[model samples]
Target: MVKVATFFAMSVGAFAFWQTMDKIHVWIALHQDEKQERMEKEAEIRRMRAELIRENKKRESLA
Candidate 1:
């Protein structure tokens, strides 16, 4: 019973400590990386769209 109570107290203390750590720097870094990723994704999507348009034109010609 005592070990269980102590474990619960330690767990709560660890949780409280983790909740207060500064995360703005980490968040900003992630956001910057995410922005770069989004830009790259957008470029890829545009390229795919252009390819699809070309394929559609070819199909139309075949018909």
Candidate 2:
């Protein structure tokens, strides 16, 4: 019947939508982790720069 075929198509479409949503969620989570790691690396670089500046200042004071 036409009604039964329509129902089957809708079900398949819903399943495909669910699968796509799951993949999107996984991709978003992966990108979020990468962003966090990049932020942490930037913070470490800033900290190292500050430390070097302090050491240079101390050496200049001694001279």
**Reference-based lDDT, each prediction:** 0.92, 1.00
Q: Provide C-alpha RMSD values for all models, in order.
A: 8.8, 0.9
TM-score for each prediction?
0.54, 0.92
Question: How do the residues 1-63 of candidate 2 rate in per-residue lDDT, one tens digit apiece?
Answer: 999999999999999999999999999999999999999999999999999999999999999
Worst 10 residues of 2 by lDDT: 1-10
**What local lDDT does model 1 show for residue 29?**
86
Residue ranges of candidate 1 with Cα displaced over 4 Å:
1-25
Cα error, candidate 1, residue 61 (Å): 1.3
Candidate with the greatest TM-score versus the true structure: 2
lDDT (Cα, 0-100) at 39 in candidate 2: 100
Q: Residue 8 lDDT in model 2?
A: 100
Candidate with the greatest lDDT versus the true structure: 2
Model 2 residue 60 CA deviation (Å) reads 1.0
